[model samples]
Target chain A: MSTTEPDNVALNGPVVGRYRVIPLIEKGATAGMRPAVASKDVQEALALPGTLVADWQDKAIKRLGQLVKQRRGLRVFLDNCTKCGACTDKCHYFLGTRDPKNMPVARQDLIRSVYRRYFTLAGRLFPWLVGARTLNKALLQDWYTYFHQCSQCRRCTVFCPKGIDTSEVTMAGREILASIGLGQQYSQEIITKVKSIGNNLGMKPRALADVLENLEEDILDDTGVPVRLPLDDSRADVLLVTPSADFFAEPHVDGLIGYAKVLHQAGVRWTFSSQASEAANFALFTGQHDHMRDIALRIRNAAVDLAVSRIVIGECGHAWRVAYSYLDALVGPLDFLDPAHSRVEHICEVTHQLLTQGRITLDPQRNAGKVITYHDSCNVARGASMGQRAGGQFRIPRELLAASVPRVVEMSADTTKQKTFCCGGGGGLLTDDMMAVRIKGALPRAQALQSVVDSDEVTHLVAICAICKTQLSSVLPHYGLQHVQVTSLHHLVGDALVL
Target chain B: MLGYLLTAAFVWAVAGSAYRLIVWARTPSTLPMPLTPAPTSRVGVVGRLLLELLTFRALARADRTTWLASLAFHYGLLLILIMHLRFVWSQLPPSLVPFIGLSGWATLMLIIGLSVLLIRRIVIDRLRYISSPSDYLHIILLLTLAASGTAMKRLWPVDLYGVSQFLQGALRFSWQPLPESLVLVVHLSLVLLLLFVFPISKLLHGIGIVFSPTLNQRDAVSAQTRVLSGSSHSKTRE
Candidate 1:
């Protein structure tokens, strides 16, 4: 079984035969993967009120026991792993960091060991024999270091015969850590921002309106079309819930433009809610259900206040998963919305429906200058479904892209669809301090992408998720593929949309 | 004494397994997390479990070597277990008699499968890194059970009629005299230990598979309506 190798020799690290052994470090000193301690403000925002330095070990153990019973995935996954090691080489972090702790089962053992010590008879009687350990400051620190290293992508689950999802384990670990106030600053800070300002980036209503208005002007200047980016229009037919990054970031902004053009051509009345402008839910990354629910309810309120018949989510992977799989449970029935369409639909599904119905027209020639390939976002591919089919998540975006682009290519089979690799900055590890880990974690996807680029001269790599656009664009230059552009699926659609 | 000890071990195994099952059942599955490409119907889920049990589907997709070894070990164990039914039955079923001879091959396959797994765990760097003392102990325990059982059959033959009479008498609530063979005693003791440990060890994976939400739940997302508990009273204005 030959695996695709990254084009950049340095990305391969120190290779012995077929395996890469990046020396395991006790801590993340070299990769700078350590997150700052959650500030008191962030902790309070998450409703996890406690002192960071307090002796909360007993409390944490009790909380974990409660969580294991509450979350079935956690309980079953912890008990199910046979340490078969089928998932040992499956994690991108393990491949990149060469850290044994990064291996999915080992990463899981950090929590499972403690679960055994507290919850299982064998663990209580013979801890060392079963590899169980007591909960202590050292174990907690290991939990913080290793859990954050995971992207919670669920790749390991697909390969695990027992169907053990390390993402569930990672989420449970994060939840337990947060209960003791040992939260990751990146995700916790974002949750705080989303709570106070209705978005991860903390952009206020005024700034959001200005950004949208400016984008409308840019569309007119570039395409000679008077496209409108409406905001908070109560009578609109669709409520556009998008990530705040789309209003500010480079390639993400272009994807936003693409969505606008598609809706404009389809003649659908859509508006962005400044109050609930953000779609990225950082709370899910931390496994904070209350925080996630509070964040999702804002969108429900936006949809209700606007009297929008339908709600359409923007290009964000994990956010889409929360919207598709969790929103209904968190703040739904959503019974008042249009029954003709899904209560919450992905932008790709909306565009695909429009193209299929001939509600919108696209000129493939407009996107003929570049050969494009789609990178299936981890959460969307493995976590959520689109349309009415099982794999609509994988097919819907590609269908829309193929409709708008003259040529489309696929990366290696091993790295696409359910086996898709993370862009390495997901699950709230996108902070600048974690760049080394991010770059290393992204090697597999980069190598797979690099293979296609070398063979097919694929000029553009498009993704539906905002984080993928940001992460890949940043990491591409590091692998000497600086010229290969990373764009959004909607970016190409917007480029080809005909008025 | 052996009969009483064996009965006690069976009771412990059954009670422990039932306790584990109750705990698993009590755990709340707050979310539906079926891995996508999963079946959306109850019938489909059954089919998925069947495929998983018969083929070790996911492991096969992951690594062929481990899958082959595991398939041999599990199926070999199953056949060996079925062959044990002959001792409990006074009249062996005609259909099953033809396959009695295959028990020798089954034992060999079990040992070979276990050796492959043990070797991989010891030799493979990645596997060795994740393995604990208990992991190695599991394989060794099974190997000893297989070796002792096989030796009693071929190397040091036991009193089959005496063993059958004792087993039948126990089932009938009539305690008969035990078979006076050292090899038989060792084999029976090993079997008793395995049963006691089954529910407490990683062997619980046998039961865990049936309850795993990712593998067993139906992916009927649209069909099921989730009733949101609390109303959204506080609204953030745009």
Candidate 2:
């Protein structure tokens, strides 16, 4: 017998290296499911010692156990469910989808079942006792698809007897998935761009300069105003951070146009920083808290560098949420800006007040529609809790909508003032990849709109957030809604300008 | 000697648990939901309380398995508390022991039910996900207390005189020697650990969850009713 054996084991066939096929760590495989590769880069980053590939496997297994344990903790609630449906009537998705899976309780059970099996001692020991199957490739894919369906609306939590935040569970799941290097590609890419370039759209200094130049051109063409859109405008009276979409997209860009026109008309000194122009922070959507911190840091730094007083966040939903909810705590207690004086006003608020004070005039005649409904973005209206200083309380937008549009019909289940419906776009579902779900998810609003659309004969849907404008505009057509252009609450004011 | 050590440990644990309970009780309950108009009542206070009890919906609604784990663990713990109250009653006037006994049996049954749930956590895969070392310890401590209490009552009755003396001494900070009963010692010791660890761990969630501000914020149904005051400060003076 030869003393030396061939290097090839032919275990499964050469997938891991030249001679060895790494057996799938997970038990079954579906078609197109790629084998887990232990990249040298990954190995270097993880700092794996020796050729112990099993080390990574073991750590993942341990983390899986921890994840499972957390999931199991969630199970106690499932088994005890009274199913009073308190949370049922509360979900916008369920109300929209009419799909039971969209129901908060029903949606929770999907992840809950998996948790029961892997973590609970009964599930682990009995295997068949509770319905937990080992998390393999198929299950992981399911987690990816369905988990993304949650928009983290926080509505269900209100009805929950115990304040169980499903959003937290969704976030934890996403983070766990990320740890395994199985992050949602688009979301991860957005986070990465935000990390490196200061914006999710990857508009760095040069790209932002180009965008400003283009925006100025459009501004000159449309309004004939030689507006100076400054970047990092030092010693400015105010620094405005508009959502990146305002520079590029329609109706939203019009919001920016309205902003410039309002600023110019009021003779208020303000500047836009090229570096921190984006108000829409996708990090909130991805549940990447650190990245959110980084983005907030950059915005704060830009404000400080520009020596501006107030930070006027242009119409964006979650951006306002981040600013109002976490900005102070994260950047905070600045000596230059009094906590009370750090005026973080929504554009609708600023313009609305200015209008009411006779600083800005609106036509209200231009928006002479039979019916106009204002859709409150979840983040803007409902993100903060009551009693907090930054709760904002949805006063400004409501006032603006009431004033700017005629026949302001309320959505059947509209959470406008306080309990506004999510645009189904928050948490970064505004992009096209999640388009189907986004369109389908818009059904709740559409169904609510149906009664008003028919009875009230609504023609225009007003929104303040850029993402809402993009998502609702793209989605409204699918629901047989036409001529109901999704315009910003600002657009209504701008177009109907009595100026 | 071991009995004295167990008793000392039990005292330490109870003191710790009481401290935690106070902290948890005082923490505020504010949820971060959008400012919707609050429902007049979720069918009123009595109806709401019933819903919380029957559904445990708040906890269950967070995620399912956690709800089950928590409910089982909680109901079980509740029963254990009732049984312990019986011990407190034995020292009370004779009339109270009968009242405590009636409640104790009901609680005993609850403990047995919860123990089944506790055991299930280990055996079930799903429960294990959220289960931590502390979780297992909690269940074990609870189970031990329940079992030991049951064993003392049935299999090995503790000397009433010794126990009474010990209780009196423990309460007064006097040195009346404790009676030696293994079950009593285990029961008492586990109770102590549960207390000391309460504030620092997820167990505090029991109190924290009830008052979580995120749940209490009125849902955003109506926008703010007030009109914009004015824009005197619109100019953002540098």
Q: On residues B1-238, what C-alpha lDDT tens digit does candidate 2 reach at each position?
A: 4335545655765665565455434433221332232322334333444555566765464446546655655665564554455444445555444555454565565565556556655654334433445456655666676677777877998886776666555555555666877777776666566654443334544444433434333333122232333333343443
Q: Which prediction has the highest DockQ against the true structure?
A: 1
Residue B206 displacement in candidate 2 (angstroms): 5.0
Alpha-carbon deviation at B129 in model 2, angstroms: 18
| Tens digits of per-residue lDDT for model 2, A241-334 | 8888888888787777777777767766778887686787776765555667778887888878877667778888778777766676557644
Name the lDDT value of residue B130 in candidate 1: 82
Residue runs of model 1 more than 4 Å from their true location after superposition? A1-32, B169-173, B222-238
Q: Give candidates' CA RMSD values in order.
A: 5.0, 11.8
The sequence of per-residue lDDT tens digits that candidate 1 reaches over residues A411-474 is 9887899998889999988887677778878878887887888889999999989889999998
Docking class of 2: incorrect
Misplaced by over 4 Å in model 2 are: A1-85, A93-135, A204-228, A338-340, A385-391, A413-415, B1-208, B211-238
